[model samples]
Target chain A: MKRRDLIKGAGAGLLAAGTGIAAPAIAKGVKQWRMQMTWRANSPLLATGPQLVADYINKASNGRLELKLYAAGDLVSPFQVLDAVADGTLHMGHGYPAYWAGKLAAVQFFAPIPFGFTSQEQNAWFHYGGGQELADEVYGELGVKFLPSGNTSVQAAGWYNKELNSIESFKGLKIRSGGLGAKVLTEIGGVPVQMPLGEVPQGLQSGAIDGADFVGPFNDMAFGLHKVAKHYYWPGWMEPSAVLDCFINKEAWDSLDKDLQEIVKGANAMANQMVLSEFVTKNAQAVKIMKEEHKVDFRLLDPATLGHLGRVSQSVIDDVGQTDDLTRKVYASYRKFIDTVQPYSELSEMAFMNARAQLKS
Target chain B: MKRRDLIKGAGAGLLAAGTGIAAPAIAKGVKQWRMQMTWRANSPLLATGPQLVADYINKASNGRLELKLYAAGDLVSPFQVLDAVADGTLHMGHGYPAYWAGKLAAVQFFAPIPFGFTSQEQNAWFHYGGGQELADEVYGELGVKFLPSGNTSVQAAGWYNKELNSIESFKGLKIRSGGLGAKVLTEIGGVPVQMPLGEVPQGLQSGAIDGADFVGPFNDMAFGLHKVAKHYYWPGWMEPSAVLDCFINKEAWDSLDKDLQEIVKGANAMANQMVLSEFVTKNAQAVKIMKEEHKVDFRLLDPATLGHLGRVSQSVIDDVGQTDDLTRKVYASYRKFIDTVQPYSELSEMAFMNARAQLKS
Candidate 1:
């Protein structure tokens, strides 16, 4: 048979097989999807990323696929997103993989690790360095298809009421942090507290927490952390480049035709690029406002402290990876890619920034 | 009249008028387009960027809008791409805006400037900092629609036969460079020569050029420059982040439906992100190969030399911007965005990299 005849035969065979699947829904004109995000309505990059994804997909598909977005608590709680999407409570979910670290240890690597890859490097690892396959292997078992939909560049280290003069400063300090960052902080003698971002401002104000590491300047400014914290820190070492994921019900994904699938992928890719760029611009503007207008003191962590933290971070990552065999496999792949990308980054980005500093001075 | 009746009336009036327009093309199922690229067939990021854009559009449109890509010299010629696309000789073209410096001096700022915005900063500026509006104003007059399709992250400075130990080394030295970089070289007393990338290896081998700056390690390795040049330099200060452009014929663009237009835009955005990520991976691997297998000597341009070059680069940019009103407008906007983004980068990306270095040691 010719190729066209073979496709026709296969199509007829599949249809005649009486698989009561997505065919009926697809034929009903516009397919509406409900997507739940693990972010507040006005969350900066997190909320905007999913919103852009929906806009892009809707515009590109010409109403063929209409996705309605729901902020956190609209349908289900934030932490319940994975289970909700997996069980088909929602067609999709927008969240960070690290949020599900309690259930799957390897998920943290897929989100962001302490002292992990930067935004550019992480995207590279995801698309080209076998990351997507490894991610599929992990998320596949959960019955959800994973797509990295956005990035919040390198986050700010945190907002601090007191200066971090040395590694000893971390001892007995209460820090509002989550995911692997919390683990690294705990290893370094700091008390790590998990609280919703909404509570961070009050937590710092009430002296419940000495510091907090949120998304970045843009989101931190939104939370009014700079108003309470006098000193803002540099380089969010815990979550270097935080990635936001779009988790689709595996059944929903499998049901889509090739064209709809491609549209969804393209939309997610656009969102991934757009959100990072938006963060770069908005974060810069927010920093200027915080520093010049709000008088927030920008401070860098001392070299010795950073060095100590880095060492502790590595140990934390190793421990987390050893929890299961799959985590170990994913962690090994992540490490190898990071090692491979480091030298080039040193020669190019690192060297350029150093040279730029000299020029500015 | 009712809304539906008004639309029906307008449709009837237009049909009665019988204007010879896009009706016939809409009746045709698939719209095939030809796109030309200003890169060799085997070029890494440059060629791949445009090819991916074509692939994305084809797949997303379900072959309704098929784009066929032509490499450099395959059609008219590399330099004639802009003109060809504008005159409708080709439906689309991929190139750098700096290539059109002779026609529009302001165009170089849109592409890459010596010591200008980095990859992340540039994308932010283009999307958020009034760059797209300014770009539209410039390109609209030329009857083409411009879209930023790809980026080559920070490039390696160059490969040299001898060491660049001080500022004096640039004086009277023959360097193969182009665009703003060549102008900066001229200001710093170097005799900048414009040569094709293919001829760089032979030029260096024959002692015709002392050093050459190419795209990063990946493309540089493909050109076999490491075989002839022993010393590899860090931080391509000249073209910090070179962006690739996709130029579509205005007439061709206007003929498409809104959905198709969005698909094109999303495809270009996807290409932009994917290409940069691809470069990060490939360049890292290439650096490793050059260092281990080829034994290329890695060197940093001394602080004093870099500082002096930075000064001259500023002067070149300032002079270039003063050429016309549009150039000045773009230059002002570019400068403002750069200033806004620099502080955040210093606190985030720069600080993280520096802290990372301390830890590795």
Candidate 2:
């Protein structure tokens, strides 16, 4: 199957070529690799990362390298995204960086820290700023090379069972949060539970946790979050911009031809955008359904509680710094960067908000 | 047209309501004016912005307030989002401050001054660094109140027609570029043409322009730039991190019920992630098409030319500074910001590239 032949087939052939199955055989007479994503087939980001890259490389090299993708749970469990990619069981995995934080503290920053950067800023940091370097350094230590695969802008706080009238309401409440947000929540007196996506609905139903936080309305609705937790909270300050990753085995990545490497990067970039746009269009319908059809009560954490959480977030960062040297380096860099820009944000964004609120009221 | 009737009809109705047709009818009996957006239909940021005050006023008045979403491109072009909302064209427009650089010199800095600041650092600037004050002063002049809607990550440079080999190739070339990049390209002796999304392909096809630049692969592919141009470029240095906005008409926004304002802001927050993620996923396939079918050439501009362009860019900025106070203020701020963090970018990003290229050869 020549590269042109594989491409001509389109659809399933495109899929097959993308995941690396018969692509190399049919295309450029090169090598093929397969990656089974942890997200559902409907997930544009998860389904297409490898596919897009494979197609690009196949086309670029006239079929020298191909990658085939398998939907979530097809080749491995969803939770295995990072592990599969890390151990070379899979060539790559598309998931959040924080999922691998246990392996490296710096991974969490790649995704989101409490009250961290938004998606746009994070991308700038990683791509143009010193972010990708830091990311590469951290992940390189573990024999994995990371590509930023997805970025979810400021997210909703989470789904709640009731309104948060004050900071005290957080005490004793059990909620599911990820990355370093769990630590922030814990600091604010809430009990934090970390669970995989598959377990969320069950957790909510069985009362294992009081509430949960996921990507946003599109995913939340797709996962039927509104069905379980009726009160959706807002201002996901803890995870303002959630970034996902495409973790490829370093050896496997380096082994690819130059064209193949470019393809992989190109494909990841495509997947990142698709996921972002789909959510933009689809989430609206989903949220509307949840609000009107299902009667979900959406709420924002009280201002006081939000402020308290922000303070707690600072302590959490400090705590992480105390616990790990790598964490200290990343956090220190982040802190210094934050401090330099703090005055600007205060005068520009904060002042406007304060002035507007008073004048409007 | 009633809120109940609209909600009962669902998605399409909400979309229609967003165009302002249904808001009046719905406002008759609604105690709570809630707005949904395509960005994030019912998120909390909406409530915090104009909608929050709208809700308050509606509540105070006992059911006369109706808040609804101003979906992307609902009342006007998405690019004109901020202006529409600010000038009371509609109660709100999804404000992407990054897009308004043409109007105000300083707006770019407030958004993300190309290759500057990570998302976290941006938030720091807006919240604590006095950036917010500067941004508000700008927006205040425009008769609008602004809040962080959401942010995007670093974007790709753009799709191009041919691989650039040397600085000479830029001379007499007409290409599609925008914002500060137009100036940068102009400095390099190239003619930079600005065209909205609809006009790019025609410009490319008619040779009205040699190439064009836009969001990233996700968006570029959607427009099928791969089909028109054979070369795709990278390192979206011009718009390292573009920020989207949720614009509100000062007077009308101020008049909105409180909860409704928060709804708008919250939805913008939600939109932020959706847009970011969409770009990530979509670009993969677009680039694939470009590589495979279009046989698009992927090349980075030669370092000498890139360096030359960078130098010219400074001159352009300097020239802008000589013309207007706002331009000078913005340039000074931007220059100071860039100078402060450039050492890090140099040591990390540029240095790594230099080291890696040596290793590559």
Question: Who wins the TM-score comparison?
Answer: 1
Off by over 4 Å in 2: A1-29, A44-62, A341-361, B1-361
Clash pairs, model 1 backbone: none
Q: Model 2, A89-109: lDDT tens per residue?
A: 667766667767887766666
lDDT of 1 by residue, A237-257 (tens): 887788889988899999887
The candidate that wins on lDDT is 1
For model 1 the TM-score comes to 0.92
Docking level for model 1: medium
Q: Return the TM-scores of chain A for each candidate in numbered order.
A: 0.91, 0.81
In candidate 1, position B275 carries an lDDT of 87
**What TM-score against the true fold does each predicted structure earn?**
0.92, 0.48
Q: Number of clashing residue pairs in every model?
A: 0, 112
